[model samples]
Target chain A: MVEFTPDEMMTIAASRLLTNDDVCFVGIGAPSAACNVARLTHAPDITLIYESGTLGTAPNVLPLSIGDGELCDTAVTTVSVPEMFRYWLQGGHVTVGFLGAAQIDKFGNLNTTVIGDYHNPKIRLPGGGGAPEIATSAHQVFITSKQALRGMVEAVDFYTSLGHGTGGNDREDTYGVKTKGPTVLITDLAVWKPDPETKEFTVVSIHEGVTRDDLQATCGWSIKYAQDVRETPVPTELELNTLRDLQSRTAIAHSL
Target chain B: MSLQDAVAKYIKDGQLIALEGFTHLIPHAAAHEIIRQGRRDLTAIRMTPDIIYDQMVGMGCIKKLIFSFMGNPGVGLLKRVRDSIEHEYPSAITYEEYSHSAMANAYEAGAAGLPCAIFRGFLGAELAKVNPNIKHVICPFTGEKLAAVPSVQPEVSVIHAQRANKRGEVLIEGIIGVQKEAVLAAQKAIVTVEEIVDDFDDMHPNTCILPHFVVDAICVVPGGAHPSYSHNYYQRDNAAYKEWAAISADRDLFAKWMEDNVMSVGPEVFEGRVAHLRGAK
Candidate 1:
C-alpha cells in the first residue's frame, strides 16, 4: 500500500500545475518547496524568480526564505527589487506566480494582512510583500494552501492581493490588471478554478479519498462543484519519491 | 576601524536609521553593536524586519519600526515584535507600514532626490485605510487615481557587503536589495565588509559598488551577517533562528542570549566564514 502525507500530496499537486519554460515568481514556504519539486523532477526549465531580486534561481535544496544564500549562489543573475517588479514582473515576463494566503474568498481574493476588523484587529498578520503586483502582473497565478474552514471564507477580512475583485471581469475592467487572475487554487482536499464568466471558484477535482462532503466541511463558504468534477490522480510512486527526496534535502539545508 | 567605533560615530539617539538588506548580508554585527551600546529613541527601517530587528526591539533600542513585512522568515511569528506591538512588553514600539513595492519605490524616489513617489498600487487593498501616509492622487495626464508616498530618506544607512578595497569602494555581490538606494538617500552611510581586498576581480554584471566618497566608513568584519548570510561566504544559520523564536519569546532568556552571544563578544568575535555556500567557486 502506498501512503503520503497531505502536505506532500498538496505540494505534488501544485508542482504538477507548473510546466517547463514557465518563468515562475516563487514565494517562500510551500511555494518554494513546490517550485523546487517541479524543477528537480518535471519542470527543469522553470525559471524561479524571487522578490528578493533573484532571477533564474536554482537552489540545490529548498530555501528557508527568499533571501537564502543558496538562491544567490545558484542563481543565473540577481536584479534590484524595483527592477524585478517593474521590468520582469510588471513588464509581463512571468508566466506563473505562486502564492499562499492566510485567508481566501470564493472570488479567490487573498488576505495576508489582518484577521479581524481593520481598526481593532484580533490578529495582525504580516502584511503583503510583493503579492499585489505579482497577483496583477503575472500571466497566471496558482494558489496553494491547507484547506481549512477558516481559510476558505465567504470574504477575506482584508483584500491584500486582488484575485478577481468580486468576480466577473472586474479585475481587468476596474483594476486594469492585464493578466488572468488566479487561474487555479490547489488545496489539500481538492482543486478549484474560476468560472469563465463569473470568476467564482468551483471545485474541479477532488484528491483521492477526499469526498465532496469533506470539502464542504472544510471550506468556509458553500462551494459550487464543476459539472465535470472528477477525482484527482493519486500521487505516483515517482512523484512521492521525488518529493520526499526534496524534503530531505531541505532538512539538510536547514540543518546546515 | 572596528564595528564598535563605526556604530558609536555614525549611529545616534533619535535618528532614522535604515539597515537595509532584504534577506542577504544583513549587518548583524553592527546591530549587535547598537544593542551593546544601548542606543535609544531610534527609528529602525527595513523592508523586512527579521531576527536582528527582533533582538534590537527586545532590548529596548528601537522606539519605532518602519518596514513592509516582519517575521522569522521560515519560522513562525516574530515573538518579540508581536509582543511589543500586542502586549507592549519591554516597551511598546510604534510602527509605520507600507507594501514592498511602495517601500522600494519610496527609496528609489529618495535616491533620485524626489519629494514623493507615485505608482500604480494600493487600488483595492486595506493598507490605505490604516496608513495615513498612503494617499491617492489623480494623475494629471490620464485623470486616473494613483497612490503616492513620500520619499524614504533616512538619516543614516548601515549595511554589510562581501568586500571592499583599501580605497573604501564597497562591492555588494548577490541579492542587492535596496541597499544602494538606501545608502544614496541617507545623509551618511556605514558599511561593514567580510574582507577588504586590494583589487576586486573584474566585477560581475548587476553588481552594486559604492565609491569611497559615498561611504562614510568601511570596517572589515568577517562573518558579519551570521544567522543571516553573506552570499558566497556563509550559509544562513537556521538553527540559531529556531533558537531565537523560543529565546525571544521570553524576556529573560532573550537578555541572557544577548549577554552570552552578542554583548560579551567584541568585533573580533567574528571569525572567518563559518559555512561558505559556494565551496571554492
Candidate 2:
C-alpha cells in the first residue's frame, strides 16, 4: 500500500512499456516524465533523445525545457538541430516516439494545432513541432494524456500527427507511412491498445477502481472493451519511491 | 561592434529575419534591441517561437510569423501569440506554419544553397494542406514521394553564444542548435557573446566555431541570453518564464512590461538581471 494518484499510475504504466533496447524520441511534459522514470527504474539503458538534439541524456533532475543545460551536460552527445532531425530522427534510428496531444480521434490521429478551423480557431494551440516526422519515422509510437471528453474526441480539428488514419492499414497503405502509429494509449483511467485488424483504439485494461462508466464518461466515442479486460496491477513500492523521488527533485530544480 | 550598431546596420523594416536558438542561448538581448528600435513589419522565423518571439509579436513588431511551434517552452501557452492569431489583437498577422523537421531541413537547404528541401514528412497530417510552402515532389532516384518546402533564407540572422576570440571568431558550446545553419543561411549575421577572450585554447573538440569571415559583426553583451541559459554561464530564469504567462495574458500589462524592461534599457542591463545566476555550472 503505497498511495499513488491516477497521473502517477498513468506515468508508471507508460514507463513500464519502455525497454532497455528502445531508443525513444521523447516529447516534453508527461511523456518526458514517463521516459525518465523508465530509465530510473527498469530500463536503465534506454536512449532518451530530446528534439533539441540531446541524445542518451541521463539527467538527475527533470528539465523544465527540452534544451535545458542539464540535458546537454548529461547527454552522451548533442548534435545540431538540423542533423538531429535529419540523420537521427528521419533516418529511422528511433524505436519509439512518445508523444502527448491536445485531442485524439478514434483512429488515434492527434491535434495539437488548434481547437477549431485552421483559418479561424476557437483556441490556437501550440502547433506540431517534431511530431509530424516523428509519427512516421519512428518504428512505433506511444501516446500519454490525461483522459477527458474534450481530449478524447470523435475527430480531431487538425491532424498534427498521423496516428492511424481512418483505421485499418490506412496509415501505411494510403499515406505510405512506414511506422506503426500510436500502438498504445495510456491515460488516467485505462490502458488502450489498437485493434489488430481495424487499428481503432480499444480499452484492454482499466486501471484500479475505474469502472466502465468512468471510461464511458471521459471518452467522446462509444466505449469498446476487450472481451477479457483485466485490472492493471497496482504500483510497486520501488516504482512509487523512484517516481516520487524524481518528481520532488524536479520540483526543487525547477523552482530555482 | 556594439549591439545597437550591428542591429541598426544589418536589420531593416519589412525584412525576413531569423533569431534562432533552440531553448538555450536564445538571443534575448538582441531581440530586445530590435523592439527598442521599433522595427516594424518584419517577418520572424524560428523553430520554437519562445518568449522573445512572443514579446516581439505582442509589441506589434512582426507582420508575418513563419514558425513550427509557438509556446513558452515547458510552461504553457504563449498568450500573446494566441491573441494575435485568434483575435487579431494589436494587429492581424499572417502565419506560415510547418513542422519542426521541415523548418530545420529548410534551413539546412538554405545553407547549402538549394531551392527547396525534400524530405519524407507530412504524409497524413493537415499541415500539408494549410501551408502552401509544404509541397510534394517525386524522388527521381527511387520514385518515392516526399514533402518539399522552399529553403528558409533570412535576410538577417542573430544568435547568442558563450564567447568569442578577439579575432571576431564566435565559439558556441553546449546544445549547438541550428544557429550555425541559420547564420550560414542568412545574408547578414550578428552574434552577441558573454565575453571576448584571446583565443579558444582549451575548448572542446566538438565545439562549433564560426570563422570571422562568415560573421558580419560581433558584440560582447554578458548574460545576453537571460531567461534562456547560456550553457555554462547561467541557469535558465524559469521564474521569469512562468511569470510571463500571467504578464502577457493582459494586453496592457504586456505593454507596461515592455516599456519598463525593454523599451528603456540598453544591452548592458542584461548583465545585472542574471548576476546571481552566473557560474551556474
Candidate 3:
C-alpha cells in the first residue's frame, strides 16, 4: 500500500480525465502539471495550446509559465496571439480548458480578482489572463485547486471566469456561452461534478482519507453527495513515479 | 543607434507606451534604460505585464498600467505591483484590466487603424461593471450585443528581436506574438536585436520580418531579453523569476537589487551573459 499527498492525488485524478484526442488549453501551475502528466502517461495525442501563442507544445519539462521557451522549442507550431485566441479558442476548436482559481462558488463561478472590495481591495489578486474566453469557449472546463471553506465560497467576490453563471444553464441562456460549463472540480479532498439540472457542484467522490462530514465542513455551501459515494483510487506506483520524475525534471530545468 | 539614444529620442514622458512581447523577446534592456533615464508618469501597456513591468512600477517610472494579466508568470503575485496598488508605496498607479483576447484584438485594431476593437466577451463577468472603459455596442449586422474597447495605439513601441539586417529590417523567428502589429501600430518604433547581419539569408518560412520603413530605429543589443528568452538566442531565466518574488516582496531589497544590477550597469553588460545558452563563444 502506497500513500500519496493530497496534491498528488488531485493532480493524478485530473490527469485521468484527459483523453488522448482532446485539445486542451493549458494554464500555468497545477493545471499545467495535470495536462503534462496526461501527455506523458496516457494522452500522448492531446494537443496542448497555451495563451502565449504556442500550439501543440510538447515540452520535455514542465513549463514554468505559458511563455517558457521550452514550449516554443518543442512545439509542433506557434501562431500569433490573435490567431490563437480568435481561430483556435473562440472558434470553438478547443475541447478542454484546464484552469485554477483563487475562489470558486457552488455554481462554479471563479474569482481571480479582489478579495474584499473592488475599489479598495484587502488583497489584490492577479487578474484573469485568458480565463474568460477559456471558461466560456472550451467545450468543457476542468478546474483544480486546494479545498477549504474560504476557497469554496457561497459566492465569489467578483467573477473573473464564468463557470455555470449562477447555475441552471444561466451560462448558455443569459450569456449565450456556447459550451457546457465546468464539468468537474478536482480538489485536494474530493471530486465534484455539477448537478445536471441545478449546475451546482456536488461531491461525487472523496479521497482516501477525507470523510463526508469533513467535506461538508470544508465547503461553504449546502453539500450533496452521490447516492453511493466512492473513494478515489489510490495513486498507482507508476503514476506516482512518473509524477515525481516530472517534478524533479522541472526543478533541474529551472535550476531550483 | 544605442539603446540609450533610442530611449532618449523615441520615448517621451507621460506617453502611453507598449513594450509588447507575449513571453519571448521582451524588451528588458530597453525597460532598464527607461528606469536609468528616470522617465516619469508614463502609461505602460502589455498583454501580460511581467517582471519587467514590476521593476518599472517599483522604480516609480510609471503612472498607470494598462494590462490584461499582472503577475510574475508562474511564481506568484507581483509584490511590487501589489504594494503600489495596495499601499501606494512609490505612488498610486491606476490600472485598466482586460482579458487576453481583448488586448490582442485591441492591438489588432490599432494596427489596422480602427477607432476601437469589438469582440464577443465579458457577457457575464464583473469586469464590465467596474471598468467604465469597457463598453458594449449592438452589432448592426446581427443585432448582437458585443463588448468594445478603444484600440491601443501607443505613442512609441519598444521590442526585442532575434536579428536585424544592416538595412534596419527586424526578424523574429519563434513564438511570435503581437510584435508585428505593435510595431506597425506605434507612432514610432524602436527595436533591439541580437545582431545586425549583412542580410537575412533565406529566413525561416514562418518568420516575421519588419521592414526598415516600419521601424524608426534599430539597436544591436545581444541578450537584450535577459530573464525572458529570445528564440534561438537564450532560455528564460526561471531562477530569476523565483528570486524576484522575494526581492520584490520587500521594497528595500528590490531597490538594492535594481541599483546593483540595473541602474549601476550599462546595457552592454548583457552582451556575454548568455553566450553559452546560444552555443556561441
Candidate 4:
C-alpha cells in the first residue's frame, strides 16, 4: 500500500484524470511524478511524452529530467524534439498535457514567467519550455499543484502558460489557438474544474482532510467551493506504500 | 565576422560545452555559432536548452550530449537528435531525470571546483552513468568522496546575458548565480549580451560579473537570446520560438534557417538577423 504525502496525494488526484490510453504531454517535476505514478498503477497503458525527446516512456523510477536514463531505458520509443511537437503535439496527437506551474489563477491560467510584470519582473522564473505549446496543443490539460495562497494567485505577474487566461477560452478564442481547455486543476485542497460558462475555477471536491472554508480562505480570487463537492477518496495503504517507496527511491537519488 | 571565426575563439575539437538559457530565458547563441562554424566532435550538457542543442547535434558539432530535455519548445524534439540517440548519432544526446537537480548538481559541483557532488536521486539511476562528464568521482574538496553523483563542468561555457561590455563583462538579472558558477569554473567563457555598454562603471559594480579581464569579448547581438527573456530586457518571443519549434520538426525548415542564419555570419551579425525577422530598417 502506498502512503502518499499531501503533495503526492495532490499529484495522485491529478493522475487519476489520466486514462489507460492517454498520450500525455508531461512536465518535469510533480506532474512527472503523478504521471509516472499513474503509469505504474492504473494507467500503465498511457503513453508519456516529455519535451526532452522521450516518447511513450514508462520508467520504473522517477526521472530527474526528460533526459534521465530511465526514460530511455524504459521508453517504448523516442522521437526528435521537432517531431514531438509538430507531428504529435501540435498535430493533435497528444490527448492531455500534464503540467505544473508556480502560480495559478481562477481561470486555471498558469504563470511561470515572472512574479511581477513581464518586462520588469519581480522574479523571473524559468520561462515556458514546452508549456505554452502544451497549453495550446493538447486536446485536454491537467495541472498539478500543492495549492497555497502563494501559488494559487488572484492573478499572475506574467502568463508563462496560457491555460485559461482571463476567462472562458479567452486566450484560445482571441488567439485562434486550437487544443483542449485546461480540463482540471489538482491541488492539495481539492480537485477543481472551470465553471462551464464563466470558466472560473470552481471546486469539485475537497481532499479527505480539507473543508470548504479552507478552500475559500486560501484562494486569491473570489472562491467557489463545489456544492456537490465530495470527499477525496483516501489513498489505499498499498497505493500509499508503493508511492512512498518510490518516493524514497527518488529521494535517495535526489537527496542533496 | 562569421560563425566560423566566432566559434574558433571559444571552442575546439573534442571539448565539452554547456550552453545556457532555461526553456526560454537566454537563447543559446554561441552553441548555434559553433554549429554554424562547422566544428565537430564536441560534447554538451544541459537541463533544457531549446533547439540550439538540436542544431548542434544536427550539424554534428557534438560527440555526446547529456541533458534532461531538448526540443524546439513549441515544435518538438529534433529528428537528428533522435537518430543520434537511437541509431547512434555521430554525437549522441542522452536523457536524464530532473532539470534543476542536474543543473544544481553540475553547477554546484563546478562552482565548488569539486570533482563531483553527491545527490540522492532515484537510487542507482541509469542516467547517472550515461557519460563521464558527470560521474561518481571523489570530491576533490571533501576527499570523503560520495557515490551517485552528477557533475557537469564543461571545458567551455556559453550563455546569453542581457548586458555586457565589448570585453564581455556581463550582467544577468536575478543573480541566479548559475552564470556565476559557470563563469567561475569554466576554462573559458563566451557571453552574447543584449547590449554592449561602453563603461563598466556605468553599471552598478555589484551587478557586474565576468569582469572584462576574464572575458574574451561581448557581441551586442541585441536579441541574442531570441526565444528567451533578456533578464530585465524582455520576455520570451513565444511566437518566434514556437516558429523555431515547428521548424525543428522538419529538416527542410531547420536547414533553411541554418543556411540563412547560422551559416551566414558571426556573433557580430546576430542583430541583423533579429532585424531581418522584425523587418526593422
Candidate 5:
C-alpha cells in the first residue's frame, strides 16, 4: 500500500484531536477523508453526518460530495438540509464541525467574497450554500486548509461563515452554534487556536522543522503563537500507506 | 426577443458566469439563453453548479466546470461531471467538493490575496487523491503551504435580483456579500430583474447589493427570476425543483425541452410564460 504525501501528517494530527464519541459534521473532499479515517482508525464509533443528509454514514471510500451515491448507499440513513442542520448539527447531535476555508483572517473571520469593492467586483464566487448556518450553528468548528500567506490574512473580504462573529461571538450562547465559531485551524504549517482574551487566532504549534517566526510573518495582522507548543508525533507507516494508496487510486479513477 | 437576440442581450459565449438564485431557487434563465445561442466551450464556476452544468454539458455548451457541489440532494448521483469523466469526453471536468465552510475559506483566501486559509477538515483522508488536480500551495509567510488558492475573476455573471434599474443596479439582502462578491470578482455582468425600481433608495443603500455601474446589460423581465426568489417578490417553487431533480438525467429529454422552451422562446416572451405559470396557479 502506498501512502499519500500528506497522509502521514494528516492522520497523526486528525487522530490526536478526535475522540471515539465525537459526532462530526463532515464536508466533502479532505474533510470527508479525515472523518472516515477517524471512523476507520481510532474513532470507530464516531457518528458522521454529511451535509447532503446522510446520517451516520460509514462509506468504504470517501464520497465526492454530500450528493455522492456512496453517502446514500447501504450504510446510511437519510435527512434533509433543514433536518440535518436542526436535528443532527444544530440539534446538538454533533460535537465537531469539520470545515475548510478559502480565506481566513487574524480575528479568524473568513471571506468568500470578492477582493475589491462590494458592487461591480472582479470575480464571481460560489455564494454560501450552508456555510452561514454551519459556521454559526455547529457546536464547535474545526477548520482545515492548506497553509499560505494569501489565505491566512489579517482580514477577509466577506464573512462568508461566522467563524468568530466580529469578536462578540455569541454563536454558542445565542445561536446554539455548537462550536466556538472556529476553535482550531489545522494547516500544513502549524495548528492554531483562538486566543482566550481577544478571541483572535494564535498559532499553538508548528510542525517539525517549521519555525515560529515563519508562522507569525504569514498573517496580515500582528500574529501571536501559543506559549507552550509541543512537537507532533510521527505517523505510522501503515496509515501513510493507506492514505497514499487511496489518493493514487482516486486520481486514476477521477483522471486528475 | 428571439433566442438569438436573448443570447446576445443577456448571455455571452466562453465566459465564466454566475447563475442566480439557490439550489431550487432560480431557474438560471440567462444560462438557458447561453444554451440557445449555442455558446460552447465555456467554464462555469458556482455553488452546486447544477442546471447550468447539466444543460451546458448535455448541450455541449460547457467545456469545463469548476464548482463546489454539483448534485441534487437525494435524487441520485453526480450525473453530469461524473458522466463526463467516466466517458472520457476529452472535456475536462474538475470537481471541488469543498464544504460550504471550506469553499468560503478558499474564496476568502483568494479574495485576501493570501495563499491559503487554515481550517479543520478531513485531513489525511481519501479525497486527497481522488480529486488530484487540487494542488498544494506553499505558504509564502510561514514557508508552509498546502492547497493554496488563486483569485477567481469571472468574466461575466448573470443573476436574478429583486429589483434592478434599466442600467442594472441590483438590490438583494441578507447575504449581500454573495451578490456583491460575484459582482466584484467578475469583469462584467448581466442583471436580470423581476422589477426595475425607479429609485435606488427603495432598499437601504447598503443593501443595494450590486450597483448598476458594473452591469453591462440590465434586462428587465418580470418574473424572470423564477426558481430563485426575488427577495420579497416570490418564493421558490419546490415542485418545479423536484421536477428538475428527477429529470437531471435523461440528457436527450432535457436537450429537447430546452429547444422547445428556452431556445424557442424570445426574451420578451419570458414575461408571457411567467404570466402563464402564474395564471395557471
Candidate 6:
C-alpha cells in the first residue's frame, strides 16, 4: 500500500466519483488534477472540456492556465469562447461541473467573489469566471476544497454559485434551475452529500483515521453524519503512482 | 502601419476599448502601447482581465473596468487590482462585473447586432443583485425566465494573432477565444501579428480568420503576445506571470517596473523578451 498525503487522498477520492461517461466541465486546480487522474486510471474516455474553448482535450501535462497552449495543441477541437459557452455549456450538454470554492455553506452555496462587504471588501477574490453557469447549467456539480472553519462556513459572504439556495426544492422551485446543484463534496476529511429532504450537506464517508471531532472542528456549522457512515476506500497503488507522475510531469513542464 | 500610429489613430480617451484574448494570445504589446501613449479615462473590457489590465489599472489609465474575472491566471490574487479595489490606490475605479457566460453572450449579441444578450445564467447568484446590468427577461417561446444583459459594443477591439497575410486577413489558431466576437462587436479593430505572409497555406481548416475589411489596421509586431503567448509562435512566460504578483503588489516597484519595461521601451523589445521561447510549439 502506497502512502498518500491528504490532498492526494482527496484527489483520488474525487477522481473515483467520475466515470468514462461523464463530460466534465473542469475547473483549473484540484478538479483538473482529479479529472486527469481519472482519465489516466479508470476513465480513459472521459471528455474533458476547459472554459478556454478546448473540447476533448488530452494534455500530457496539466495546464498552468485554462488556455495553456498544451490544452489547444492536444484538443480534438477548439471553438470560440462564445460558442463554447453558448452551445456547449448553456446548451446543457455537460454532465458534470467540477469546481472549487473559497467559501462554502451548509447548503453548498459557493462564494468566490469577495470575503467581506461587496462595497468595501476585506479581500476581493477572483470573481466567478465560469462557475455561475456551470453550477446551474450542468446536469450536476461536484465541489472539492480543503476543509477549514473559514472555508466551510455557515453562509458565504456572497453566493457566487447556487447549490441549493436554502435547501428543499429551492434549486428548481425558487430559481428555476433544473440541474442538481452540488451532488457530492469531496474534502480532505470526508465525503459529503446533501440530504434528500433538507439539501444540507451531511457527512456520508469519513476518510481513514479522520474522526467526527476532526470534521466538526473544521466545519463552521454543526456537522451531520449519515446513519451508515463508512470509511472511504484508501487510494490504490495505481491511483497514487498515476497522480504523482502527472504532478511531476506538470512541474517539469511549468518550470520551463 | 506602425503599432504607435495604429494605437493613436484608433484608440481614444474615455472610450470603451476591449483587448480581447483568453489566457492565450493576449495583446500585451498593444496594451503597452496604449500605456506608453498615455490614454486615460478608458473603460477596459475583457473576459479574464489578465495582467495587462492589472498594469493598465495600476497605471491609472482606466476609470472603469468591465470584466467577468480578474486574476493572474494560474497564479493567485491580482494584487494591483486588489490594492485598487480594497485600498483605492492610484484612484478609485468603478466596475461592472458579470459571469463569463453573460459577458461572452453579450459580446456575441453585439457582434450579431442584437440589443441585448439573453441567456440562462445567474440563477441563484448574488451577482445579479449587485450588478443591476444583470436583469431578467422571460423567453417568449418557453415562457421561462432568463438572464439578460446589454450587449457590449466597444469602440475599438485590439488583439494579437499568430499571423496575417499581406492582404491583412488575420489568422488566430489555438484557443480561439472571444477575439472574433470582440473584433466584430467593436466599431474598429486592430490586430498585431508575428509576421505577414503572402497567403495562408497549409493551415488548419478550422482556424479563425478576420477578413481585411473588418480590420482597421494590421501591425506586424513579432512576439507581440509576450508573457501571454501566440499559439504556434511562442510559449507563455509563466515565470513573468509569477514575478508580476510580487512586482504589482507594491506601488513604487510597480511604477518603476512599468517605467523600465513598458514606458521606456518600444514594441521591438517584445521580440527579444521571448527569443528563447520562440518556436516553442
lDDT by residue for model 5 over B2-46, one digit each (tens)? 324545765566666665333322536676667667787677766
Decoy 5 TM-score against native = 0.51
Is model 3 an incorrect, acceptable, medium or high docking prediction?
medium
lDDT of 6 by residue, A16-125 (tens): 99999999999999999999999999999999999999999998999989999899988889998989999999998999999999999989899999999987888999
Q: DockQ of every model listed?
A: 0.64, 0.92, 0.69, 0.03, 0.04, 0.90
lDDT of each: 0.86, 0.93, 0.89, 0.64, 0.57, 0.93
Q: Using DockQ, rank the candidates from best to worst.
A: 2, 6, 3, 1, 5, 4
Candidate structures ordered by lDDT, highest first: 6, 2, 3, 1, 4, 5
Q: Give candidate 2 regions above 4 Å deviation.
A: none
lDDT of 3 by residue, B89-192 (tens): 88989999999988888998999999899987886888888889889999999998888999989999999999999888899878788899899889999999
**Model 4 residue A74 lDDT?**
64
Better of 5 and 6 by TM-score: 6
lDDT of 1: 0.86
- Number of the top candidate by DockQ? 2
lDDT of 2 by residue, A193-233 (tens): 99999888999998999999999999999978777899988
Q: Poorest 10 consecutive residues of model 6 chain B by lDDT?
A: B200-209
Query: TM-score of each candidate?
Result: 0.95, 0.99, 0.97, 0.52, 0.51, 0.99
TM-score of chain B of 5: 0.78
Superposed model 1: Cα runs more than 4 Å off:
B201-206, B272-281
**What is the docking quality class of candidate 5?**
incorrect
**In candidate 4, which residue ranges exceed 4 Å CA deviation?**
A1-4, B1-281
Residue pairs in clash, model 2:
none
